[model samples]
Target: QAIYNIRNNPPQEDGACKLCNHQTIQRADETEEAITNRLEIYNQKTAPLIGYYEKEGLLKNFLSLIASDTIAEIKKSLKV
Candidate 1:
């Protein structure tokens, strides 16, 4: 789930280190303030935009703790 979120919603700027197997982790030279700013924007804006759908009763919250059972639960929740 964590990987999925990170990949689907990457940072505003695309950056990767040459030595780290092209990993998405921010480069060491980047300042801490840059990371904080990105997180703040995500928290203050991006997160809440998607949350609106959940608030409108059109979203399902799966139990991430039960990985194997998530699909079944989501299916049952959205039963037709």
Candidate 2:
């Protein structure tokens, strides 16, 4: 979704990497098609790993981390 958003409506020249906090510059030559292809490849590679962890009941959903206390939630989940 993020990539698609960028592809369609790219950021102004002042975007930054969320993780590294570094300035980001979109390549002028990169196309939406290229980004979509890359995203598909990423999904294909990661889907099986995600499924494996889920099947083993080892996948810990951290999606609620922003709304709840992170440490407390992690501890509570670990107790089970």
> All candidates: CA RMSD in angstroms?
9.8, 8.5
Model 2: residues with Cα > 4 Å off, grouped in runs? 1-30, 65-68, 75-80
Which pairs of residues collide in candidate 1?
A: none
Across 1-80, the per-residue lDDT of candidate 2 in tens digits comes to: 13424656544445755545566665654767887888898899977898899999999876553655776788888994
Give lDDT tens digits, candidate 1, residues 1-76: 1221345655334444333435465455355688788899899988896779887977666767776688778777
lDDT of 1 at 52: 93
| Best-fitting candidate, scored by lDDT | 2
Task: Give candidate 2's whole-model lDDT.
Answer: 0.69
Q: List the residue pairs that clash in candidate 2.
A: none
- Counting clashing residue pairs in each candidate, in order, gives 0, 0
